[model samples]
Target: MTVILKKVPESEKYILRNFCSLYLHELSNFTMNLDVGEDGIFHYVELDNFWTVDGLSPYFIQLGGDIIGFILLLERPFLNKSNDYGINDFFILNKYKGKGLAFQAVEKLFKEKQGQYFVIQVAENRRAIAFWKKVYNRLNIETHERQDIIDDELCLIQTFKI
Candidate 1:
């Protein structure tokens, strides 16, 4: 029942790459339309940037001792904002869903990183949208939402200041 967000180190970047491929595969069900390349792996082009970039934090969602998924956090402003942070990616394995672990993990993160932040979910991903809605409601925080085009696809962005 112990959910933790373990910060990933540079030497463990490969772990993020491997898990992100699976995360993307799971996301393919929700309008991601991802495809594996000739190498037979779903490559995340920005995996390297998480380490090299100044304002990015990558984490592995762990339950006790086992790694279940990951969350990628980005700092600096986005979506035309001057000072904001963002949840770049979040995923929990199917087996881990509906157990309230996601809420605990994110709540713990919000407690540690307090600032203006936004999270974007693909417009077609009702599951993601629902999850974020529940998160905000449970956190009891006010949020601003809008529909916007990102990477040429319609997305729902939720902005909040904690």
Candidate 2:
């Protein structure tokens, strides 16, 4: 089954904001980089930039009209600049894991915007590192992995050309 990537409309901006809070919460387990505001919500300061900034895209990952996750695509990522495209954020709900949807979604995005692409993970996120490795293997794409400090935190960066 092909998972669809739908461009998020401005009208549905709130939906993306809500989902990003959840995504950030999950990432907190690994990076400890995010926290809830006094308002009792996790606020993503960059979420609004997708609508106003150049070289950014927001998409909802769908399975037959059901929105299961979201991905934020970048033309020139803030964290890494060498690659032509970067994944600022990507998430598939826990229930959707181990079912190949993530692989399918990444495959579709990478193919649609074929070029030098990169993905970054918090250095301690071993699960994320393994997941990306499998994705690369399944796609059979050559990759380069290295370590760098981004935002003052150590991160694992992987780059590839499609």
Candidate 3:
């Protein structure tokens, strides 16, 4: 499985939008309810800003030329703190989960975008928390975990310097 990150092109923006809906649908099972419009669009605000914003990067996680996931990275620091790159969104399709593909994709992402990294996972998403922990541990990097309240929802935040 050759996992690669390809920058999403403007012409393929719809692909990301569709994937965002899928990601949101999966997240809704662990987090708060989301109102995806009748057209099944989720994260419209962020989607709009991502296209116009300079610091935002949206990548398609491709496995041998097939897109199986998406990752959204914010070049800016988390909460405006210096040196932190925010992992705004990460999702692997259910059919591709638990195969170490996410680890490979994230490792490539970190190598390509090196900086202090911050990732937030819904407190209720035990799988996500465990996945990040395992990834950091495998890399032998020290990570700091904390609880934070974002948008009035408690979340698990993991920060690491790589």
Candidate 4:
């Protein structure tokens, strides 16, 4: 399978919307929550707007002319920054999961900007923690906690020093 990675352009707005919706739905299902209502979809729209703004540098992973995944790399206040690089948001469609596409996306990002540290925040729940731990451990990237909180759920920060 040929995978194409390109910066998101205005023409692909619909693909972005679909990708975000499917991704959020899958995540909500994984958390055993039916909370992804209309409001939730609207929330993703707002996030998409922010990421879609000029200079944000959103990217999409396309397969056979269809967008199957996306990775947004932008600066945010809450995340730790190293030389202005942060692994902001990365997700793939459920059908495309477990195929090592995520690892490939991250690996490519790092290779593009060599020696820049990349960090991803994982929810402090069982599934998220396990998934992140497995990836970072296999890659042998140093993991460090910046912040963690448990309100209705738990959240953990996983940092990868590249």
Candidate with maximal lDDT: 2
List candidate 1 segments past 4 Å from native.
77-81
How big is the positional error of residue 117 in model 3, measured in Å on the Cα after superposition? 1.0
lDDT of 3: 0.85
Cα TM-score per model: 0.93, 0.93, 0.92, 0.72
Inter-residue clash pairs, candidate 2? none
- Cα lDDT for residue 159, model 1? 87
TM-score, ranked from best to worst = 2, 1, 3, 4
Point to the candidate with the largest TM-score: 2
Error of 4 at 62 (Å): 2.1
Q: Candidate 1's residue-wise lDDT over 5-46, tens digit each? A: 899999989988989988887777766557787888888888
lDDT of each candidate versus the true structure: 0.86, 0.88, 0.85, 0.63
Q: Candidate 4's residue-wise lDDT over 98-135, tens digit each?
A: 77776676667766755445454446335555666777
What RMSD, rounded to one decimal, does every model reach? 1.8, 1.9, 1.7, 3.7
Q: For model 4, what is the alpha-carbon lDDT of residue 61?
A: 84
Q: What digit string (tens of lDDT, one per residue) describes model 2 on residues 27-146?
A: 888776788888878898889999898888999999989888999998854435567888878999889988999888998998789888889999887878899999998889899989
Candidate 4, poorest ten consecutive residues by summed lDDT: 75-84
> Residue 12 in model 3: shift from native, Å?
0.8
Superposed by TM-score, candidate 4 places the C-alpha of residue 92 at a distance from the truth, in angstroms, of 1.4
- Candidate 2: deviation at residue 15, Å? 0.5
- Model 4 reaches what TM-score against the true structure? 0.72
